[model samples]
Target: MNTADFIKARAAALGFDVCRFASASEPWSAGERLAHFVEAGRHGDMGWMETTLERRAHPTSMWAEAKTAVVLGLNYGPGHDPLPEMGDASAGYISVYARGDDYHEVIKGRLKTLAGQIAARTGEDVKVFVDTAPLMEKPLAQRAGVGWQGKHTNLLSRTRGNWLFLGVILTAAELEPDAPESEHCGACTACLDVCPTQAFPAPFQLDARRCLSYLTIEFAGPWPVEFRKATGSRIYGCDDCLAICPWNKFAVASHESRVQAREGLVSPRLADLAALDDAAFRALFSKSPVKRIGRDRFVRNVLYAIGNSGDADLIEAARALLDDPAPVVRGGAVWALSRLMDDEAFAALRSERAGGEADASVRVEWAADQA
Candidate 1:
């Protein structure tokens, strides 16, 4: 077999569901869309996107000698739908992508091994990336025939639905490129309709400022009041769009043990989550993708869900966090109080904020709730 055929076989053996190659040239069309997304401030506080503009547009700019870009996809589809659990106010919803071990560590380790094997055989230089680098993985994956970018702007494969994790290997050797997949979304707008925050301003576009994923994970300060209600009980990330995709019927459960859903993570109790102190939070999420948000942000997300839950049983939990060190958490506590507390209880919490060292942002939330 030729080198390309041999590499393809090796990729399948390595557990990659799909693999394809493309030139490390500028994905100019994607770059233009990215430029517009940035210009419109759609990326919100993700300042890193603004800094790495040039490198994200062209893979060659990231590694000048990169002649071939091999894109690989790992399927992480769960055995059951993850959406129904979102409505259970007692349970917190973590994005499916984060339910397992962190993909960066899991996928990169496999990619590095594959790259080493390729290098040993072909004697070519190789570098691998798995969401940690400035590479435009979704665009490259589409160009490499793994899938087309869905209306939600995530890579979607016909065989894997939208349940794939992308990784890239940049090499100095040129390999035969795969034909890019044609867009299959057609007139379907299921993803856009299901957005809790209406994050997509237009088809295939996202305004991160309003996205629950960004509000819960990427954005550092207090979440905007307008989106707090829509965030629901999703403490880690949102999966409304991905879960609603009609193509998901074709998705099969992933075999990667590391990506399988842990029992506690699949549907953690919100009351238990709200009571988590820093140490408890660390212990529970250690080595998981949810750990990246840190204890405070995660707690903030939980608080928003608690407020929307309207479950009076959770009132005590929200009260416990009234003195949280992080303004973001305290603000969410205030919002939760507003939603779950009676007029008297809210008045009591409002009085406490008057003499407290709460940030102006939190005070705004406190005042709004009181009003």
Candidate 2:
């Protein structure tokens, strides 16, 4: 077998679902698209995208010697559609990709192992990248024919559907490139229509400011009032676009045990989640991607879900957090109380608690709810 074939076989043996090669040094329009996205301020609070623009523009921009990109994909498809889980208004809906172990930790070591083997065989310098680095894995994966970027702006595989996690190995050795996949979305607007916040400005563009995943995971402050009600019970991430894809019909359940959803994370009770202290949060999400958001932000998300729950049974849970240490959490609790309590009760509670609140943002939440 040739070098590219050998690399694909090794990746398969390492548990990757698909492996393909592309010219990393090739000029592509992806960088320009990214630049447009950032310049338009669609990247929201992810300031890092603007900070690393030069390096992230292309693979060769990061490493001048990056000749071939060996793109690897691992399928993490939930055996069934997870969209229906949102019907239980009292439970939180975590995005499917985050329901399992962190993909970075799961895929990084394997990419390193494959990189080491490739270097030994070709005597070429190599670097491995999971989603962490400035490298754009989706464009590389598409150029390598691993998948096409669907209208959701996520890589979608004909075989693996919308459920693949991507990793890339950039090598100095030039390998035969695979045929790039063409867009197959074909008049389908399912993904765009499914977004609660209508985050997508157009078919393939996203405004992260309105994205629940961005708000729940990356943004560190209280969400705008407009998005608070739209968030519904999604505490961590949103998968409505991915789960609604027609391509997913061809996808199979993932064989890898580590990427499957943990029982506790799937459709977790909003009230129970709101009651977790930092210690319990760390223990529950140990080794899980949810832990990266930290207990404060995670619980803040939970309180939003509690507010949207309309269960009133969870009122005590939200009330209990009114004095929590994190200002974000306190703000979220205020929002929850506003949603779940009646006019007289909310006004009384606001009168009682709003005066002593020191945080400006939390104060704003109270003031906003009063209006």
Candidate 3:
């Protein structure tokens, strides 16, 4: 077998479900799409996308030595349907990928190992990236025949569907490139129809500001208010549009042990998550990606979910957080209590809390609740 074939075999041996190569100089339109996306303000708070455009748009621009691009996919298809639990308002819906070990952690070492193997076989410089770098993995994956970007703007195929993690290996070796995959979406609008916030502006365009994944995971501080109720109980990342994809029927459950859902993270109780202090939050999420959001941010999301829960039993949890030191968390608490409590009780709590609150943002949240 040649170098490319050897690498594909090695990737399969290393647990990758699909491995394909694309020429580093392969022409693509991701640059134009990205520029337009950023210029249109669709990227929201993700300013990094703008800064990384030079390298992300074109592979050769990032590194002139980059000759072969290897895009690998690891299946993380959920064992069971996630829609039912997502439907339960009292339960917080953590996206399926995040319920397990962090993909960056799980996939990084493997990529490095594979990179080392490639280096040993062929004397060439290499860089392995697992979603950290600016390199556009989905576009590269599409160019490499691994998958196509679905209507949700996530990499998906009939084989891996929407539940796959991508890792890219840029090498100096000149490997034969594979034929790219064509779009299979046909006239399907399942993903488009399922978005609670209508994030997609058109067939392939996505407005990240209105995306649940962006609001719950990427966007900092409090949510945009208008999208909070539309977010439902999604405390972490979201999977609504992805779950609605028709190609998912062919997906196989992830075989990797580390990708399996952790005990309580799949769909946690809103009240329990709402009560987590910083220490408890850190201890629970340790190596998980959810830890990156920090206790305050995570709790803020929980409060939004609790308010939307319509579960009167969770009122005490929301009320207990009215005095939270983190203004963002307290702001979310104000919103939740306003939704769960009657006007008289909510008014009294708001009156007591408003005098001492320092953050103008939180104060605005408190005042808004009165209206």
**Best by the TM-score measure:** 2
Clashing pairs in 2: none
Give per-residue CA lDDT, model 2, range 112-204, as digits (tens): 999999999999999999978899999999999998998899999888889999999999998899999999999999999999999999998
Q: What are the candidates' C-alpha RMSDs?
A: 1.5, 1.0, 1.3
lDDT for each candidate structure: 0.86, 0.92, 0.88
lDDT tens digits, residues 17-64, model 1?
888998786445887888889999898889999999877778887888
lDDT of 3: 0.88
| Ranking 2 against 3 by lDDT, winner | 2
TM-score of each: 0.96, 0.98, 0.97
Q: Please tell me which predicted candidate would have the highest lDDT against the true structure.
A: 2
CA shift at 367, candidate 2, in angstroms?
1.8
Residue 165, candidate 3: alpha-carbon lDDT: 95
* Per-residue accuracy of model 3 over 1-371 as CA lDDT, tens digit each: 88888888999999998889988876778888888999999999998988887877887888889988888899999966788897789999999999888999999998999999899888999999898987888898888998899888898887878999999999998888999988999999999998999999998899999998898888888887778888889888889888888888888899998988989997789989988999999999988999998999899999999989889999999988978889988889889988888899888887786578888988898888432
Clash count for each candidate, listed in order shown: 0, 0, 0
Which of the predicted structures, 2 or 3, would earn the higher TM-score when compared with the native? 2
